[model samples]
Target: MEMVRVVFLTVFMFFVLVTVHEWGHYYFAKRAGILVREFAIGFGPKLFSYKRGETQFTLRLLPFGGYARMAGEDPEMIEIGPGQTIAVRLGQDNKIKNIYLDSLDTRRNVIRGEAEFTDLENELKIRLNVDGEITTYDVNPQAMMIRGSQQTQIAPKDRQFGSKTVGQRAIAILAGPVMNFILAFVLFALHLQMAGIPVENPSYVKIGEVSEGMPAQEAGLKKGDIVVAVDGQTIGGDYKKMITLTSAAKGKEMNWTLKRGEETLSVTMIPRSMEGETGGKVGITPELPTRKAGVGETITKSSKAMVDTTDLIFVGFKQLINKFNMNDISGPVGTFQLTGQIAQQGIQYLTYWAAILSLYLGIFNLLPIPALDGSRLVFLGIEALRGKPVDPAREGMVHFVGFALLFLVMIAVTYNDILRLISG
Candidate 1:
């Protein structure tokens, strides 16, 4: 059962992250007038699928991760505006066409003075002639967005991506990660601000329940004994977080300060042990902090939750790195199998983890690692600085190597998980 919980946590985390990451890319790519070919959840063989617009959406066999297949993202298709439209020859050989558009509207083609195509297809190679200047557009059109599937048909002026301008493209790519970050922030803040939940008043620990034959019972602690202090340490604000300070002193002798009915007393006891990678016991049950919230209190608690969530993601990443160094990662077989067991905890535990995983998803994707949105942003930044694009071949090679390295890392983590499972 314990092993199951571990797997459950891993798989649950994986799905949440993958979905958010891909959604980031999908959202922006579409917005930018870049054609998206496919959006897939998971990897390996395709499990199920549906088609919407020009994209064939897929649910892959592996539940570990997902991808957004955007048009023009293919290094091989570097020649393509990333949108497809047939270019109408503007002049007899020598003169090209001129098109104009505002800087902000994200588009692949059909700008000011450009001859727009009548229709678009999933794959289109077009070159717009503007006076003497010839411009290229590699249109990756969605079927629905195109005028029709019929080869003879042409879309209206608005349907083709080749009609858009450069500024539109930038906005499209920028939208995905921006949305992901916003999503993380909103979900996290909402979870923090969940209203009217009773909180354990920092003034005292009102004993809610005592388990049969537990350490509290053996220590002569009874129901309604308000604990003023544990191990001579003051417990204040964020009971869930405070429990950790107490739990950390597990097995060491500790003193407690208590109050009941205008009476105060001191007692000494040791905390009990529970299941964890780190063994910490918790005795007291807590309600939410004060349900009544002053504006200041509400702001303080929300700030704490954001900070707490941030801390947890960093800690989890650190832990994963440590475990990887020690060869301690779990694979798919372990994850979903564990998910089945974690389901026993019902929705509350799942909800808690979902929120936690969402935060991680936002943070991890923002890391400036090659092949990720952050890394691409870095490349764009370089382009802006240089006033020209980076060497496409070099960027491609870097991403290739980065992808390979990450795959190896995943394998290592999976090996560790399996080994740990067997050893346990």
Candidate 2:
């Protein structure tokens, strides 16, 4: 039952995060007048689907990733080559409104013949040999291409992704990461509202909670007791200095001066060495004072926190690059385990965890890795400078190779995660 709950929560969190990210791309692509073929969640067989306007929205079986597929994003275009049989249905204006590639035997009042040549993107016309006479027919702008039971709209040159200006294309690609950042900010603010904002002053360190039978509790220290000094050295409310002193004590007796409600008291305690570690702990958690925030304060504090978190993530990434440790990184399995642990703590912790994950997702996507948003922006920048886009075939090959390499890395990371879980 515990495992089940964890799995459910992990999947739910991933679903929410992925949906928001893809929605960003879908929204901006529509705004830029690009024809989005599909907005799909997950990568496996479709479980549900709905059509709205020119886009088909689908939910698939897998829950790990999703995408907003835009027309002309791929290098290969759907073609009706010479000698291939096809059927066409004409509208009132005598233009082909639907082109059927299959299932022509059952349909009535349709012209079936061999396709001599076709241009669906620019010319919007098809040349066919009907009863030994070759003739060309114009196709409607919104004509449907039917294959079996599936129907997809033909993308004209104007509605394709590549036809848009550089600015519009950049926005469509950049919006996904931007939306993730917005979600992180909103989550951070909501968490702060539910759980009071932390006090930023670092002058004094007070005991928030005391563990039973710990060194601090045995020394008669209680919650709300402010540490004034340690070993005759004034703390001056420096939390890090006080922590350093106690951790260095290493089971040695130390004199501590405490202030409790306008009363000064002296106490002596010995720090306990942590198991499998060098530092000594007194078993007391420091109090981070918090209070309810108003609307203005919430906005200010949340923005500050978001910025601080982003800086920390960049620092961490630098350190990771310098050292390049595999264990330092987490994959899907590790994230699932961590999510379960955080969800068990409380709603406030879970909300904060989600915010942190969202921010990380946003920042990670901005790295100049191939097949990512950052690399797309790089390509756009090159196109703007050169006044033309790169060769689509070469670009597509690079992305495919990058995607394959990333898949291998993901497999390695996931395997490591499983090993750690099993050994434990």
Considering every candidate listed, which one attains the maximal lDDT? 2
For candidate 2, the TM-score is: 0.79
What tens-digit string does per-residue lDDT give for candidate 2 at 1-424? 8767766777788888888989999999999989999999987899999999899999998665789999998843457778999999999999999999988897778899999989998899999999999999999989999888878789999989999999999999999999999999999999999878677765777887788888999999999999899999988657788889999997799999999999999999999987786777787888766779999988998999899999999999999999998999888888888999888766688888899889998888878888888888888999999999998888878778877887788889889999999997
Of candidate 2, the 10-residue stretch with the lowest lDDT total is 73-82
Candidate 1 stretches greater than 4 Å from native: 1-17, 75-174, 193-289, 292-300, 311-324, 327-349
* Candidate 2 displacement at residue 204 in angstroms: 15
lDDT of each: 0.57, 0.88
For every model shown, what is its TM-score relative to the native structure?
0.57, 0.79
The alpha-carbon deviation from the true structure for residue 363 of candidate 2, after best TM-score superposition, in angstroms, is 1.2
Expressed as tens digits, the lDDT of each residue in 1-424 for candidate 1 is 8656666665655666666777776776677556666789988998898877666789898676678775545532212132333233223333223222223133354332243332233334345555646665543322122222312112223333333343554455455555555555555445445543465455545675666665666666666776666766676444554477667867876777777678888866677687553645546565333365566655566566657888977887788767744443445555544555555555444444555555655666667888765676677778778877778788878888888887786787677777777887
